[model samples]
Target: MKVHLLIQRTFAGLNTEYTSNPAIAQLDNKLFLTDERSVVMQITENPVFSFAKNEKWTCYSFIKRALDREKRAGFYAVRLFISSAHKLTNVKDCLLTIAQRYEFFIQNNTPSQEYTDLLTQINEKAIIEKERYTFDIESIRKGTYYAIATAENLEALFADERNEFVEKLYLFTTNIDSKLLAEFHLHSIDPLSVVKWQINDEKKALDKLWLENTAIPVFAKKLLSLQGAKLYFQLKGQQEKRELTGTNELKTTALIIDDADKCITSLKINNTAVKPQPYFELYALATDTLYYTLKNGKEIPLPITAKLSTRKLIVENSENALAKLWVNGEELPIPTGKKFEIYALTTDKIEYTIVGQAGKKTTVNSDIKTLSIHLPNRGQTINDNKKSPVIDILLYALLSLLVGGIIGYFYRSNTSEEDISAIEQKIQEKEAKYEQVKKELNSSQILPNNTATKTVTSTTTNTIKSNNTTTKTTNVATKTTNTNSKTTK
Candidate 1:
């Protein structure tokens, strides 16, 4: 379904300057304008039509029209352009190859009637878009791919090389009715519509298909084919519908999503309401995974099962929008009572902030998950209770010491001269009193006092030589006078 070509074309010279039409003078001048600002030679078609046909030119419109003509061979021819990655190089031989592939596909497109029936009855929820409906037969480790497309896309499907079509047998297996098929065939649709296609090992699903009650020959043949001829007798032995235990009564069991991250509120199995159960008995079948919503307003997927076979089960959320309330770790049901619940925060300090949202009032805690705060309500953080009272006493003592130091510093720095003089006088008087006490203590001391002591002394001198001299002179004068009186008187 692929086209590979080695195309070769020969180029020839022209006679005219640019265009075939003379009226388009501007275009001719523009096309022929050169880097030197002068009009270059324009290309003219060969005089003979055959000469022109053989010649190749640098003209886009001409090439496009010729290619368009080539593509009109069929939708397959045009489809080559839709999937233009291949250039879809459809020469004479490439066109024949595409036709052959189309023939093979039409011949092999048939599927079993059961498959067609299954498509006709498939649920809309199960039908996938994007050209193909994928059926996962997980047990058989196989998948079936079906598509609805135009004849062009169908041919392109082959060229697409959808994986290697090995011995596994690449074919379309459909389960839609003839009416839809007719519609698909009659019109080349933009949005193609097709039915479901079941994959290989599809026989396992027949257990839920009501095969036991069907008496049709085709159903019987299908059963034989699925069981295999070697085990036909063994399968026949187990075919009889025997009620082993009619005494086992049906019980209601809650469903849960086995392993899911998302919370589901409205869940439906075939379409009745169901809840989640932590544990279930042996008589349960897990058919669907559903979601459960908590009071914290979180949705999670939980696996679901019924104690008895349910024809239809559905779960829908019926709670109000203001139902997001949780205490401890558990989520509570929606609160519509007269009184609201209280919360005890473990933090020492809490702040309340307000934000304006359009015209509505928004608080800081409005978006808080663990704790909820109502407007006009104050919050406080929890303080540590383990600190000793001795710390307070130590702090008070340090404060007193600091105050005393500050007062002493100010007394020294801001003292007046009068105050300094009075202090100096008082210091002098105290020093005199200390000296007097020191002398008294020296006189009364038992140990020898080595202090220095001072003592006072006086001396007198007399002159008696003058009186003796005067007496001697008077005696001599008297003796002389007596001698002279004896001589002269």
Candidate 2:
């Protein structure tokens, strides 16, 4: 079941990809697969590299070698264009099936309905093997599933699948209209690579595809050596405004985040968790380069797995009195008393409950912009700490007294003209009243009762204290009752 895809030797950064699904090529009804045709050099290594001469000589030598090799080794071999998953248990039947399909198409220019039904049945019943190779009539292994790689000085046909930390690949080209991914020269495929890009000398980001197949694992190793790269690619859909209905089966743009550096403590895509291939980069691209339209109506070179980071969330609370914290309806495990800068999205709903005699819940949505999560003090309730009623009343009373005293002190301290005049008038009136009282005492001879003059002189005193000192006032009044009989003096 070996097949060949039309590709060309490129002269810059190489990109390798493949696909088992027919929709990726936008040819669900029809598929194109071929056998290894005429070529000159070994299909794996670029023959141009053999000649360290000028670029022109390099390409010339490579193609010449391929042509020579094809003439020497070309033979009729059984190749297949299968759409189903199957094992090569019976090689004779499989080859016959391929021949039948090819012959029928050559005669009718399209597969008959019966032939299409057979293809579907084969795909369904095929026992897909992991090695990606098919056994011949002699049980010999041949790469049945493989990919085509296009890059600088390299046009290779390999069967090994890339299992690395490559999430997605971006193929940038000046040729915005070029639909197919091919070598810069070949024209046999439906659409060829006529795209050009104005890249700089540093090559910050050249026209890159999803996975550099072997290059990614090599880069993954390098990334591990450098403690990992924060680079990422996200899975995207092919349509711009496609609804996210559950039935719409979305595919990953690229595949695998092969833990090059082991920094990713966790990984999830669209809610499905996937493990990364350790010590590798991205799995090799299975199909050709794909393009997806985004919501902005712009054609992005995508539908590949890409790099995206998890949002950070930090938890802080007084005494760390937090029990359960729910985020977006999911309880997020918060370790006790552990100082860590965790990450989560801010748009996600955040709520928490305190731990104590009464566990109360609270929200973490005060500052959505800032990433910090600070919970209230453990004892601090949503309605502040409850105080005793007595204490509250005392506090209020003290506050009122203090205010009244302040007002009185200020009023007494101010010697306004009006206050002075009022005081003087009172003093004059008091003096006049004192004079009148003296006259009355002289004219009326006001007297007290005279009885045995019980002069039991009792001294009474009233004391008023200010700060720490006391002022005393004493008053004495004697009353005598007159007796008609002489007092028994």
Candidate 3:
């Protein structure tokens, strides 16, 4: 984090011209104040509040009130300093009595909860006095920098403050440009109550602050850049244990250990955690099987009753290409020029190998220990496994036919010729009945009365023609007889 300090000037009755300091810059997690006298003060990872000259008094007063409020809330004010003209001096002790007397003024003020305990410790070990240290023109000119230090407990400063108490003092001599003065400064002076110790312990103190105050969730996503094997914290007893695995994304899994010491778990892809479930679930996209090994045995078998609900393998092609699918180590033959959807429900890992006629190829393998639902080429998705009712019915019918065929095969092997003939006759009878029903069904469109009428009309026309032909024959016979009679007469 980088912070910029801007200094400006303002006078009571004159136009205030200000010069900005560009040479001095704060970087990283540290603050530095330097002067022409070669005196420098450094604070590591300190939170500094800056203000314009016009706002200096208000800001200083706000900080004072904030400190006093924290003191009353139970935090101990440790060391206060006003730094300027090549020196740092303690001024907190001078205001301690005033703080104690006016401590009630900050009774309702809001200070961070962390400072409360320190202030209480400070007030407990202090005496109240009526005189208050006041900041005036002379004091402001002498002190160009101010700082406050606080601690939750007093014992922290016993070692360092005892030896360096005198060295912390500062002196002012010559008049310097107002621009050189810090825009705002205040310090809480009490060795036992400074909060510096907590800040010094960066890992313990700042880590919590970072987790709570910073965008750590976003940073956690960026942590995926540190790919390959990584360790994550998991609860084991009252302590956290590092669980290591190879991953390309941030995923959580439930750690399960079998009696044979084999580990089984699940993983999430793209950092998408399983929702509405207490434990994380991983899905294989291209496979429809679960992988598991028998305890103390190397052989893995697909249970006969194992079924998958959310697994499918799909292939799509527009040309003559064979797509090969492999479950575990078995490769499936896929014909070209057709799309296919295959579902395999087994208790083992399924590996899908896809090859194209045009040299395009891909392989996807999923561990059965983790539930994964994936698709290849965004082509097709396999959802939860559901048994179709029609398929179930067909399976039952086929099983019945197979059983009957087996029984009939054995029965016929021992049967006599008469019995065989009788069976053949019965089959023929059934075939005839079936044929009759089929014919009736095929001629269902023709009415019975219409068929009968057509038949009767054809019969009547044939009979009439026959009768005319007979009459003609008889007439010819008579004509021949008359001709013979006339000739004779």
Candidate 4:
């Protein structure tokens, strides 16, 4: 429920100055506050109260006069805009409380912030302090609404227009107890004249206890009449009762298991614990939807059953979190301090994969009741086994090269120019002498030159570059001659 508050100050021979917490539109202010009927000119025994509604909003206005020397100077109009379903009685006490406080502020000459503070308090009280049952009202079809409420004497607001209330009958149910008390307020554009009411297909004239408010008999297996209690109606075609019970066992076949050891653990639904049976055939409700709580304190509704009925899969991540786990290309969030559980219905198979596992897909047969998977640990992601070896090898090679470059840099930086020159000269001398010795050995080993020869060549070259220094070495390219006539020397 949302409450929009607007306050307007109107004095004789002066333009109306208005302020609203949520900033109501000028048209709404004119309709609910600045209008002559809403503004009280004189102090009266009873405060002026009125209701106005538009296409999108309904306004409740209360006017209270501030007295100066027992003479009426001006008046303040407090208008509340809310959903059409809420009644003025719901906020009457709060309205009076605010009016009395305003009277105090006027007498004491309080600042403007006090008004803002008062509006904030009232808004908070209406939204947070006052508690109301959360009802799931769904329109099944034209003129037919299916609602689930937790408490008795639950009143829901519906439009009185023919287009909105096209059907003659509406259905309601309560899960807390068999008894369900309901009131339907058929509101129209004009509140004074609401359409007449009737009961059932008989067209019996159901008396309107108040304008736009009517109470009908409670619907049960057996007909029962009570004040403000409307009877539940059966589905158009089905004979079975559509009554949903909180604890009554509808069916028990699904199981929740640990992924690590395939052991069954106790189940917790919405923070309530349920012990498993001996064979772990957990009792499940005959409902299509279930909720999973995320680690970030958010609840996500997931489907328990798929299109097909026979094939059912109960999947849970008991050992690891499912934040990065993907099922059929959909990411499954990890539950906070609980195992992530789901009852999925499938036609053939359920395909799932780890996020970083490089498309390593796993398939579970629809016939199988349980699924085993190694989910990623909390705050961690699954690594791809196929890509890890190459990554490791590259990392090792890079580290070796980096270390060698650093050593070479420091050695060169510490050496003088003279020492470097001396080292280069010594290396050149050693290379020249080695080449001369290699040439003499090659000449001595060659066979006689008169025969036809076949030549074979082998070459080796090595190069290392690091830290602004490059060294290249070429090994001897061996040439062997195989003659037709051997040992002809």
Instruction: Tell me how far the alpha carbon of residue 220 in candidate 4 is from the true structure, in angstroms, after superposition.
Output: 22
Tell me the whole-model lDDT of each prediction, alpha carbons only.
0.27, 0.30, 0.30, 0.39
Comparing candidate 1 with candidate 2, which one achieves the higher TM-score? 2
Better of 3 and 4 by lDDT: 4
lDDT of 1 by residue, 322-353 (tens): 32433334444544643333231221122322
Index of the highest-TM-score prediction: 4
Highest lDDT scorer = 4
Q: Lowest summed-lDDT stretch of 10 residues in model 3?
A: 54-63
Report the C-alpha displacement of residue 328, candidate 2, in angstroms: 2.7
Best first by lDDT, ranked: 4, 2, 3, 1
List residue ranges in candidate 1 displaced over 4 A: 1-291, 295-379, 382-397, 408-489
lDDT of 3 by residue, 1-489 (tens): 011112211112111111122432221111222121122212212222221121111111101212222232112211221112111112233234334433443454434213333334433443223111111121122223423334432123222222121212222222223443342332223222211110122112111111112222211322211112223332212122233234323232222212212222231222322222222222321111234333222323222121222234454444323444565567656544355544442333554433432344344433222222223332222223323346534533453454345435534463444444554454445446544644663364222223433443354345435544555676689899999999999
**Candidate RMSDs in order:** 33.2, 25.4, 23.1, 24.7
lDDT at position 96, candidate 3:
43
lDDT of 2 at 99: 47
> Residue 162 in candidate 2 has what lDDT?
20
Model 2 spans with C-alpha error above 4 angstroms: 1-310, 317-320, 338-341, 356-360, 366-407, 410-489
